[model samples]
Target: MRRLPIRPFAVLATVGTLVLTGCGTETGDPGDRPSSAGADRTIRAHKVMQLTQTHEETGMTLLEGPVFDEDGRLLVVDVTAPEGKPKVMRVNVSDKTFRAVRTQGQAAYTSAQFSPYDGRLYLTDFAHGEIVSLAPDGSDPRTFFSGEIDGARMNPDDLAFDRKGNLYVSDSRGLREGEARGRVVRIGRDGRTVTVLAKNLAAPNGISFDEDYQGLWFSELTENRVSYLRLDGEGRVTSSHTAIRVDGGIAQTDSIAVDANGNLYQGLHGRPAMAVFNRNGERLATVELRGRTEGLESATNVAITPGGTKAYMTVSGPGGGFLYTFDALAKGIRQSNGG
Candidate 1:
């Protein structure tokens, strides 16, 4: 998914300023703004499992899309794995064991989540621009959504489903092209109606419904900010605005999750950390890796348990692919499950 070179932290500071001023309408009053000077609390995450080790020829492992299943097992995808290798795996966090979930074809899977309606596992194939599904045990592979929509090719990065079983996806084309070619699409439970909810976004990567399901929160990677779209009863975008403007330094916003309290857990790329933000776009705390971050730099996606007891992040780089665990800030409901 990261086809572009990593930008320096200095460069990002300039970019962040431009994005904050030009992106969208800002919510919350200036007087209510929480100080961005630093996080109130800092939590250290420990490694729970290492999926891959450092390799020379094969390159650094890039892991993404950490989601929990109904049985409480963690599911993740390795976007850099070659063909014949296990692209998806089920990790039993209790014992630190894992099982490979067979996926057909050479698609580079980026995200995974179990549908609350059908109880099937769905994944976004970043390489093929397709959304595929399978059983919990990783059987019955089938394509759910694919190809172009309204003449635009999809570069699906992350996805989430609503309580009504409607699926939403972030088509991340802008990050690679450096333009506003990104889009957010919604598919009805019938699996036939595909609706384009929002367009002209700057590489929208992560997506999740708000606590009340009245709107959606998505991250724009190129813009270095997170935006929200107020939705109608029909799941159409009524209005939208920028919620959080992040100074990622060397990192860019990737996947995100919303807790029961409507707090957003925004994952970062090129930095081993997850930035927590409240509904008013205030910084709460930052969860970071405990030890050296020499090679493990990509902390792209995170998922919290149903009751918000624990949270896990998928990190990968030259060091290898690993899952890091920490405590959750709020109760993790359906909105924080996959995205």
Candidate 2:
């Protein structure tokens, strides 16, 4: 693995919320849909291409959270590096070029993505129980959010964005870790925290909002299921539903992405595989990884381009790393039966 300098925020102590934003409240009416981020428009689909291996031709372990930037660079979290030296890798899509985005000792990033509001990359620091925000250029990486360091309750993993600019961060902790049950939280812009959503879930790892902006969808890893809930007025979770059910979440249910067409794509844990759920919560299709090795090892994260044609996923190889692109180059994206 490549080595890089690390930048970690030194922890002082837990700073209790000055004022909590969203907490458990009365379920509001279903009319609480906020204004769309932008005028409704169609998301054009593009030809999907597989990302080539950056290290050797094969055999580099996966880097977490493979997401794109405005400059066409794919940023991935390299977690399996030497202890006290986890880092982010930036891969240039144009020529399969790559570089370390940031470095961190004592903190391994589990998941990451670029904020639509700010270009900063928000990545989960596994060791610190906090979020790391990196400058758009990969400089000035520092602590972004955390409930408690080494605190059993908050096990932040995967995250997503809503039109309101708030974030949906899920805790993958199961019941055994009583402090942290599998739940979803809505983090406001001002860093105000609130458990606006959630309950007893399996491994609630990945989450996403529907195109209609009326519902929140998440993946339950252990249960091998994809669950969802409709939001009422005031951004409160109203009705909980299941979008798709699978016997096994092969990829640890790493990440998820939804298209304007109402189709949901999920990255599995170990297997280099991606699952699909239609709007009606129907199992539409599953895309497996190509090439040698054990089935696209780490389909860690999934990303849908602005156009929606290509579905980009990460085949995170810790022993060896590579980026796998699943574009609709030959076959077109199938229709879904989801709501």
Candidate 3:
């Protein structure tokens, strides 16, 4: 049964409708001020499908790491199920129909990305501290890398790849807040060598390249900040700094996606919303979700489609988790070279 909210909230901004801008405060909270992009045409995100529900025994129906598959289905990771089993499910966006992927072993898959270069799927296995690759049809799983760097454990949480086939991974090291054990590393195209790009991070969660591939952006959960790194030809961080910081409204900044015009869409773990920012780190808009999807507690991650017209977000709330689709005015940067 489709569990609907007690009361439904009206759409704040309809799709393709232009709005007027309002003055905003320094904190960037929606209540204090309106976003510049808010005046522009916006789309009120509607719930597309309920992907997972909370399990009675474990209460862990958390969903994360959503990616569009080759056949246009949405692939997501469900962390908790009956008997403490973790697995991945493929969902048909058009009909909201889904089924678990057939796989072996303890399912601790956290994230999945389709490699445009080699036509395979890359996934992060948090349980074994390894990265695995699989066939397009979810078969022939094999370990890509499962080792440490500088004697620290490689507790990878999220990954992003560049056009040259290099993969960047954020190692959380399972550290708590304020503990700076998190780091970001890169796997060479050869897939054998692991190089540390930066260290002493605070719960680094999402890793993504900018529109032109000249800069990299990542989110720090504990610090509530997003940092940008400029890279030279050799894939080395030439300079870096904090681009944006959340003060009061949103709690934990999770995954991030970049649009074609360099606007960033960030997911919040403590707040049921997605925050948008310009290239200079200015808050452009906040798409808040509540009473839109059943049991939605927080927005965990976001992904913008190729042309940037549509967006997909993963939410983990009270009863279970859901995947949502909406019309996005900002066009997302199309990943190049088969990302």
Q: What is the C-alpha lDDT of each candidate?
A: 0.73, 0.53, 0.63
**Candidate 1, after superposition: displacement of residue 292 in Å?**
1.7
* Candidate 1 structure quality by residue, lDDT tens digits, 200-299: 9888888999999999999988788999999998899999998889987767888888888888888877677777788898787777777666666677
Sort by lDDT, top down from the best:
1, 3, 2
**Between the candidate structures 1 and 3, which one is better when assessed by TM-score?**
1
Q: Comparing 2 and 3 by lDDT, which wins?
A: 3
Question: Top model by lDDT, which number?
Answer: 1
- How far in Å is the alpha carbon of 10 misplaced in model 2? 23
lDDT of 2 by residue, 25-114 (tens): 001112222223222122222213333343321113345566667665567765544433336777666576667666545454667777
- The per-residue C-alpha lDDT of model 1 at residue 195 equals 91
- Of models 2 and 3, which has the larger TM-score? 3
**Alpha carbon deviation, residue 167, candidate 3 (Å):** 0.6
